[model samples]
Target: MAAVGSPAIVEASFISRLVTRKTVMIGLLILVVVAVLAILAPWIAPYSPSRLSVVNRLKPPGGTYWFGTDEFGRDVFSRTIYAGRLSLLVGASVVAFAAVFGVTLGLVAGFFRRLDTPIARIIDAMMAFPDILLAIALVAALGPSLVTVIVALGIVYTPRLARIVRASTLVIRELPYVEAARALGVPTWRIMSRHVLRNLLSPILVQGTFIFAYAMLAEAGLSFLGLGVSPEIPTWGTMIAAGRQYIGQADWMTLFPGIAIILSVLSLQMVGDGFRDLLDPRLRKDL
Candidate 1:
């Protein structure tokens, strides 16, 4: 038999391949720009998102205000920039929470076959509820707050992520290397964490990107419905909601914020697709 490659070598090769993809580079650029905007919102924004100037109310984009002012005379450009921070935070936090919790549960369930059926059934029950409806219900019951929104979104996403991780874990668990680890007197947790989890990383990362995109949209939906972060907080969803009344006369009020949400979501999805293809060796070969 040919000698097996070291894990570090395999990982390095994978990273090299991922870097070579044009789509990956573009995706990275988009993500980096958004991240920078989020990080520097306070410094980059010309005015406070919540600051009101009656004289500037509903002003269209011009030399005075780059993205114009909203109904309350708050700078739309400022709000949009700050809102980017909230949107990115919600997306990243929700995905991170869901992925970590979901993957852990999946690892436990998949490694211990005795727990699989019941755990799978529970996940199925959660999945039976429509994702948005479930999120709404959770938020409603928990009350409308930023933490509640994050928890609701995280809970709503966990089941789907768990299913994905479970399937991946199941496959990885059956791999000969996992069996070898077990045969060598490795503890169950060690085998699962060290061997199986590492093997499942690619799929988990791909799933996480999609989850981040979905979380952003979900947060917007909740905020639009007045169930998300407090109105005092400037978010893209709340900005759009507040501007809807001026859709006809002050189109800039809603248009720019809406476009930002759309573009962010689209970029995330595109990046996710690119990562999916890049991380899967079979898919990479097909490309």
Candidate 2:
């Protein structure tokens, strides 16, 4: 081993810590595989996800249909792969939307005393409702559609990010560097963006991962309730919903898609936990 605290030793130790974190490593591997499959669905899927064949409908898993056929005789395997596209799309879109609006609200609320009460109250009122209930209400009012689902979920989750950011920003703004920047007459936007925002990234990133997972699960729940994307779309939730009627006869219909959702959500949770441990100073020191 190199001398204690040496750069090489530090680098190697970091890598060692990462490797030893089984949950993170496994989660990352699973996440990467799922992402790759989703991204390559157009080329990787063997048959059209929407193609129908009445004669082959509800076929059990066998040589011809790997994961079996759905009620419409659409290939479950293909649909499962294609379904990831929407799930991932919603997750990513929601993250982008939430982060942009949430971060702005948080920074302003934490840094500006005049606006804090109003913003904080608004956040508190929104959080008063259960997440799923609020999301369902938003989707219902917005008129369900891909865009609406994304927008609804984004709005529902924004407060969570905003609250986290506001709490951190409240503390950060009182830091010497931030106070010094203010004392020097730095522009409000510049101070928030440069000084406060940079320091806020670690929590933002960690929270973002959890939000990504929540978005995916929420999208699935909405779709399962027939309020998400149209049934014609092959989202995992839709697949399971469509298959529920034939559960006894065609178990594969729900089984494969259910597995997909579970794996994807679980992987995200594991990854988020890993990020929390790695990024939080107290947790990092313990490691």
Clashes of each: 0, 0
TM-score of 2: 0.94
The residue-level lDDT of candidate 1 at 159 comes to: 87
Q: Model 2, residue 30: what's the lDDT? A: 91
**Residue-by-residue lDDT tens digits, candidate 2, 1-287:** 57999979967876788788999999989999999999999999989998999999999988889999988888999999999999999999999999999999999999999999999999999999998899999999989899999999999899999999999999999999988998999998999999999999889998999999999999999999989998888898988998899999999999999999999999999989987897788999897
- Error (Å) of candidate 2 at residue 57 is 0.9
How many residue pairs clash in model 1? 0
**Per-residue accuracy of model 1 over 194-267 as CA lDDT, tens digit each:** 89888888788888888898999999999999999899999888888988898888989888889888878878
| Candidate 1 C-alpha error for residue 172, in Å | 2.0
Instruction: Quote the lDDT for 123 in model 1.
Output: 93
Worst 10 residues of 1 by lDDT: 1-10
Q: Can you give the lDDT of residue 94 in candidate 1?
A: 93
